[model samples]
Target: MVIKGLKHDAVAYNTMIGGFCRIGEVGKAEEFFREMGLSGVESSCVTFEHLISGYCQIGDVDSALLLYKDMCRKGLRPEGLTVDVVIRGLCGEKRVSEALEFLGVAMRNHEIAPKRKSYEFLIKGLCQEGRTEEALKLQAEMVGKGFEPNSEIYSAFIDANTKQGNDELAGMLKKEMAETQMPKKQE
Candidate 1:
């Protein structure tokens, strides 16, 4: 296509790569990336983000991190969403510690603070790993950030404490559960 001048640009390659990744055709996506490299078409941050996210979706942390490092080496700093994908993927893979480490790396490397969803993922992962205290601490942090813990997060903490026979904690959580704010009826 470049030879014919029909579509010779990074956007075209990025779009094709994104399409292939979204359709779960990761191998083809990788092939396209390699082809872009061979064709002298530089990969954009979007392209790296897509490929790293695809690898993460497949639970391929090693590959994802390799891609992340390569992107850093190329001076292309990953955005918040890139970090979010890898963090969520790590949690899904039951690697909460690794996920936390990755979160730290993102903070240190990019100086980018995570959003609420990122904290949610880490809290849930911590709960799943039987670290309710850590989860609750994370919840406190979220609250400090002006984001109240959702019902699901509260429930997870309650469940975790209950399983460990921590009735006091459960009681506290139950007491603090979100109160329904019904609207007043008009006269």
Candidate 2:
């Protein structure tokens, strides 16, 4: 393609980066991402999205967070998948506070709406960390946005509230779970 007078543009670079990321070759993806910049091709949000996803895939949530910050610094508003990946990654690492902070910031400044799965991860992570109050608040927000809480979330709430001796809330959660006809997660 180079010999055919076609320089590697943003699209080509992004494709290569995305390919590497999908295959879990995040290091190579990063190399190409940097080289893409050195080659005078402005990286798009998709470029960052690919690399960030790669880092997340490899359990390098910190690295992904750095790239996400960089993307924000460059005035790029990440798409929904990118937001989901970052939130899921942070929650995977038990960094629920940071995930909540990121979500809060995005919603406050950019109105970024995460997918239901992202909310589920964040809510479950918070519950696991014994931050059930915050999790419940976040769950309310998610529900307010039209996301139906799944069985896992209801189970999480029931388990956490029961463990914490919040019997009223736990009983209410169980009743709600029954009303929804969602099966409870077996202990």
Model 2 alpha-carbon drift over 4 Å, by segment: 3-5, 165-172, 182-187
Candidate 1's displacement at residue 149, Å, is 0.6
Which residue pairs does candidate 1 place in steric collision?
Answer: none
In model 1, how many backbone clashes occur? 0
| Model 2 lowest lDDT segment of ten | 176-185
Question: Model 2: per-residue lDDT, tens digit, 74-182?
Answer: 9998888888888998988888898988888877777888789888999899888899878888899999999989888999888888888999999998998888975
Q: What is the C-alpha lDDT profile of model 1 across 1-187, one tens digit per residue?
A: 7587785579988988888888778889999999889989999899999998888777787788899999989999899999998888888888899988888888998997887888888998898778987887888878898887777787778778888899998888877774522345699
Of the candidates shown, which would achieve the greatest lDDT relative to the real structure? 2
| CA lDDT for candidate 1 | 0.85
Question: Which sections of candidate 1 miss by over 4 Å?
Answer: 2-7, 178-187
TM-score of 2: 0.88
Error of 2 at 160 (Å): 1.2
